[model samples]
Target: MIDEKEHGDVMEIDKELMTKIYDLRRRLHSIPEASMHEMQTKAVLMSFLRENTDLEIVDRGAWFYAVLKSSDDRIGDEERTPIAFRADMDAVCGQDGKPGHYCGHDGHSSILCGAAAWLSRASQNQIINRGVYFIFQPGEEIGAGARLCRDLIIEKNIGEIYGLHNIPGYPRNHVLTIDGTFACASTGLEIHMIGTASHAAYPEAGKNPGPALARLLLEIEELTEEYNRSRGFVRMTLIGMDIGNANYGVAASEGTLRMTVRAEREKVFAGYVDEIKQIAQNTADDGGFTLDIQEIERFPATENHAVNVDKLRKCAADQNIVVTELAEPMRWSEDFGYYLQETKGAFFGVGDGEDHAQLHTAGFEFPDEIIETAVKMFVGLALM
Candidate 1:
């Protein structure tokens, strides 16, 4: 816990602070390191956090945290569980080698850092009711960092959590409180279709897996469309397709299908997977194809805590920011969904820049305009 005497109503982040944050945001954008490989990112962030604030800092190398203790002396120690704010600090891989900011993780880190500065500043005058935890995690591009941060957050016994991402199409100053479908559920599966090896010229001597694999892909789409229509809610997608043996001649034995199944509920997720597997297996069997399959839960559906959703709505109103209550939940997946699984926390997206392409595209950059707004908003919640 940070020294409480240093906390309170004194927290304020003005224009000059916003400038520093904007510069830092672009600087990180230009570097564009992928997830779990954010060493330079960690260095720059640690330097900034140390230079800008007097908060107690905890560095776990890949994942670091900073805590600002509340100034209230009358508050019981048990109620002092810190409020956590998380930002993933990594870029996506397997891109066009252009070093893109497709997901605005670069922006996410900068905002969280700025929020830390604001909280530190707020700790100066009046006592905040709960401590603040600033979490900067690495390797979120592959969706592994949040699970790693989840343990640390639990170890610290954080009371409530909040997280943010920059979204496409939303305007600046719009604060969203997504009550449901804030994010979607997904699982990654890798399927290998196998066949016997034979010379391409002598294909008749060997069993070919190509026809079987092709049938599987076609059937998957049909089955998914059927499921989507039946439920009228869930959506399934085959995100990847690779088939045939590396060799041209050997009656290509090994093929792989990588896909994600998304749904609003676990039951929907279960139904999607069970049906897909059965259809695929039956298709492969008829085609004389051998199958080696592995499906891993990639991210669970992120449901906002009811009270948190309400509190942040009030928090936005208190900050005088425009609120857009979502009519539909997002279909994208976030590892932060893991944190919400373990604690009462909320993750919301900030505005996407003008003409913004969807995340993971090379043509993306962090917008500097909203930096101060986010910091001030979190500061409002912290000091309340």
Candidate 2:
């Protein structure tokens, strides 16, 4: 049995908690670790989790799974139906060469840590339904980290789960989410144009791969527009055109283009990928270039659970939270979709203040005001 008084007795989502969350976010932001190299992040999260819950902490490389139990492994109705709250803990490889917290993942981590601490202190009478599992996930930006926790959830018998991510345009101290607004499918794509290297003087010998890459990039805009019209949620972006092998002496033998595609529906997204392949093949054929297309990461789309959606909707309603249904759609993606794939859960957005610059971009800071708003909402959801 949890100590409800212990949970309720402290922190009223006041200035103190806000300061803590803010400080945590900043500290994490300063030391942004990319993808699976989140050892520092894992250590900090484990320290926080251990200080908060009585649950066993299982640290497996890039992921940590903490299970909070009730009645100490009993039979019948006493058996805990585990619930999970997860937060992704990887940083973006910012363009500035400085580790950046532009993704607001740092904030997401602090909020989850805060929630775990608060819920762990809840009273026996406050143990409304079942067990609580705090999942501090690593390497979400790279797409496969959640796979690290796949077996652990099934083995631990976790029933339902939920996760939170921050949104840029939404007002701080408010919440914005529509049940089916977020796209669950996304991937970062890289296609390399490889050809024979030859001396610049021998124009007939070397196939400059740069021209093929140029053609490929030009065609992508049309493909993106088509996807916008047909799939609406499916979108593609070509990010890089790297042909730096410039020396009037040697013909460019290899070129590369970095791209990403995102979609609300998986099948539609698959169609886009197939279409992209066709485009690349045709482009390569004409330009005498060989293409090496490899996906950097695949982040599956998130489908909100019917039950969790209803629960959060009601909770937000009770709190008079501001809600926004997407006018168009967002191309951003999250790995939290992995948990939703396995269990009944939903990933949601909390406002980061309208003025805040977009996430994953330089100059974006996790808004200080949103900290309390997030903490309160988690408390409300947990206690309920």
Candidate 3:
């Protein structure tokens, strides 16, 4: 047994079992799959759950979860609400020119698995008073994972849900959470402009939208200032711009503008989108160009329920783990926000270490040292 006095809330972590979880993380690390393409990874997870746990597997096309139902005899008699835990199972393309688990998703999945294994082992003893669901989500990097599983959450009547990401720049093992938004909402916008092409020697014969594109870019920046001043969290970034073909003999007939917009709230992001569309349409008309706009990959801000935040803090304290109340929501976006929209919960963060390599970088690796801490934290919450 790990001493509770030294480690705080972690009273009895199984060392041998934890070693197995670390090995599982290594296996997952070796077979990194991106976004919705997690077939092989899914197979591995399925096999592990089948052979080692008694939980029922609920498989959707791109995502799956293990559900541990409470015994019927103890159902509503117990006042405890059903709790859910989520772990993202997709990897990201890293700087090494290959797909890898640089975001520590491998660790996250293993932590959930470890907690599930313990719950399964302890269920026979009736340690848990209510049902528990362990959700393995895909496409979290592309911001669609939780949305895809939204139905499952609703069907199961999950009373509460929780998730965590490993943060590399904070003190190791510290748990960080916020009361309101935990991350920002963001979406990509693509604007395409089309015009009649003609010979460069007779450029006046063709409608050139170069000037219009320039004006729109400038106007978009100015609009961003207004939104940021009023909303306090809006930001727009011009990612790329393209016009015409490589051939120099013809006046450019087409152009494209790509940008990303983000804000702390969905309302603010919607406001940004509406204004962008208005500006694009006006500019296209003024320049005599036809326009097409496309919205790409979107993630809402991860907002935490106030009660969930308190629960997380109490759980961390029970595990003798330190908890940090974040002053503001992170500017980055997460699809985990979708879960919060469906149920009451909080998506917290666990510190990897102040000196650990940053996420999505080739040099980054998930540290094994924090695995037990993560497992204990989740298990503690379920017990609560």
The prediction achieving the highest lDDT against the true structure is 3
Per-model TM-score, in order, reads: 0.86, 0.83, 0.94
Candidate 1 residue lDDT tens string, 107-224: 7888888888866765675546677888898876666888888886678778788888787787766886688658877777777777676788898776666677667778877877
Superposition error at 184 for model 1 (Å): 1.1
* Backbone steric clashes in candidate 1, count: 13
lDDT of each: 0.75, 0.73, 0.87
Superposed Cα RMSD, model 1: 4.0
lDDT of 2 by residue, 1-384 (tens): 132344324335445545666777787877888888888987887786676555578777667877656543431242346667888888888766556677878888898877766666663444545667778887787788787876766876777677787887776766655566454588888888888888888956988878778877778778888887877667677787888465878888888889888888767777888888789988988887888889878988776776787777766766666665555445677777777778777777887777889877877777766766676666666655
Better of 2 and 3 by lDDT: 3
Off by over 4 Å in 1: 1-12, 73-80, 198-205, 229-232, 245-250, 278-289, 295-297
TM-score of 3: 0.94
Pairwise TM-score winner, candidates 1 and 2: 1
Give the TM-score comparing model 1 with the true structure, all chains together.
0.86
Model 2 C-alpha lDDT versus the unseen true structure? 0.73
Best by TM-score: 3
TM-score for candidate 2:
0.83
